[model samples]
Target: MQVDADFRPILGPQLVRLDPMRIKQLQDPLVYSSIDSLAKLSAHCLNLRAPLTTCEKLINSDNTLYLAWKFDEEQNVSRLLGFAKVGRKQLFLYDSQMQTYEGEILCLLDFYVHFSAQRQGVGKQLIDYLLAQEHAEPYQLALDNPSVTLLGFMSQKFGMSKPVWQNTNFVVFDELFQSFAAENGEKAPDGWNRPQTPRRIGAVSTDTRWLRNAVSGHQSKGNAMAAPVDADMTPQGALSNRAHQAKARKAHILSSKPLW
Candidate 1:
């Protein structure tokens, strides 16, 4: 299922459903070790901030199936927004083989927007697109973001009901959901599509504080907590991993003496 291309731009980025054809775009080793690992990290952070847990797992023991959404633009091929998905096992655990009595359970497992894209409509658009999918059950959406106000706005505007209080975050429900119209009161700004705007993301918003604090605190705390992770260098582990790899390659070339 897909929305019209015209509407896609207004949504800031188009939400492309994850399938074998499109999965490669979502698997960015730079941002995530595996798409599976990215989902787990997204879950962990959302849980830490919202303090809720639904016991969702992004990767199965066998590592067989995966699902996700990748947001992208028409003009800029290199520029991308973020991706989200649900592992098959996570769906099973959450509903016991899809026996959800309440509503259709769609878990937002992994979500990331380029820092440049935060607070833009990327997330909202993704959620909106998900809601518009074909479901055999009622519309139940679960995510652990600590966006009480935005979630509340979404609940009201998109017909989602109140979110259930979980340990780490809230799981919201909606019987009838649709793509957000610009007229919707909870519409997110199109700042993401705009370039060269100096916007302080978390300043006026409640959602920003937690992320800003988490990142700031993580950086200030230094590499001690992250040293172990630093050892296993995945393509996506470090901010400068690509550059470091390039430099190492250059150094190797310089140090090695060539024989004629």
Candidate 2:
């Protein structure tokens, strides 16, 4: 893919894609120092121990693509605003009917925006540019341990709220399954059922243990905590009970097996 050019005008002056060959440019004190500052900023935003990607790793890895967003300042100076690191990896899903696992998919490894530059639509612009360049849609790609902020952005921007449950750490949306199945020459039967309504934010939880426990509790009682429902139960208690039951029902398909 092409690198060292501005992909989006509104975002900044430059959006460079770094590879093994061009990564050496980061060794210069001016360039590498700015990247370190951006990395520290990103780590603060995500509450991470350190930056997920370093100049050393980018210079060595072949499978990863590093896209940096930069802004040209006065006197021909430039600043690193933020960056996104994406890597292609296999995505696996369990097919209950076939009792097996399916693979071969692309995933987003890491994405971040400097805290100072956030809320300016920089992240959305970056992702849009990347998707267009790759000729891929958001639903066709999976995410690896996405932060809550990223999840909220995806839901609001791309409607990526509903995810197909899988017994793996990687999270894939429902659309990917259909796309992959079609590519593998598998077609759905006529009159196949599908969701009737659009997915809402926070409708599904990725925590398998919480889902499993909620399901078991719901089947036996009305709430995950198994609290007794009586005349003394307040409206809030009743509402909580109902919510737990709903989560259990939604998680039924995924709770059947462990995510090991």
Candidate 3:
């Protein structure tokens, strides 16, 4: 497959994708031994099982696009602060009527910022750049087995909390099917297009201290907890809240059902 035109080198202030030829030039040990070493370090820090792509693989792989965040150190040397890997893949999706079908999607395969670079908006910049370059919405792209930090980043930065249930490993937002169908002129399978009101799960407050602990790699004292939905309600109020609770529970079950 040919690389998408939008995957061309991007030279933003915070990140860059070097030209494919330039990347190929790194095969020379004298030129890019440090960068190659950094790539291995990045993968190890992210707990990756497979080895990261070498410069040759990066240049030869038509489907995968690699991007790196750049930081200028003293003496004008550039450091690889972080990197991301994205690729197009065929995905099975659910239609508005809950029918299963195959579609093309961009998948975020690997994303990591150096531990020191985390929380400094480097990851966000990379994601935003990919979204804009591909002319795709955040919900349209899929993530491959995201880590807790990655999920939190998506939730905090893009409001992508509730993902659609899929048989595959990829995580995509619930609205993906509706938007995909609208853009493609495809109709949902018969009996599957019934209109349903979107349900809002009651907000649960997050413990900021717990989140901080998690981010700092501390042995979490406990889970990153959310306040109980009915923690402050009186007995009478709890009784009164039963109907709403039932409705929310039902919605949650329906939403969690396998779309396949």
lDDT for each residue of candidate 2 in 1-260, tens digit (9 for 90 to 100)? 11233324323346666656666754465455556566666777668997777767677775354455554433343445567777665443533232222344556777777665678887788788778766779986677777777778888889888765555666667655545456543432333322211111133312111100011113123334544433325678668879976887768757885322
**Ranking of all predicted structures according to TM-score, beginning with the best and ending with the worst:** 2, 3, 1
* Per-prediction TM-score: 0.36, 0.58, 0.57
Cα lDDT, all candidates: 0.38, 0.57, 0.57
Question: Tens digits of per-residue lDDT for model 3 on 124-206?
Answer: 88888878776778887788877677778888999988766566767777666556555545443433332221211233332
Q: Which of candidates 1 and 3 reaches a greater TM-score?
A: 3
Error of 2 at 247 (Å): 44
Which residues of candidate 2, in runs, are more than 4 Å off?
1-13, 25-27, 66-68, 72-77, 95-101, 165-167, 182-260
Backbone clashes, candidate 3 = 1
Q: Rank the candidates by lDDT, best first.
A: 3, 2, 1
lDDT of 2 at 63: 39
Model 3 scores a C-alpha lDDT of 0.57
Identify the candidate with maximal TM-score. 2
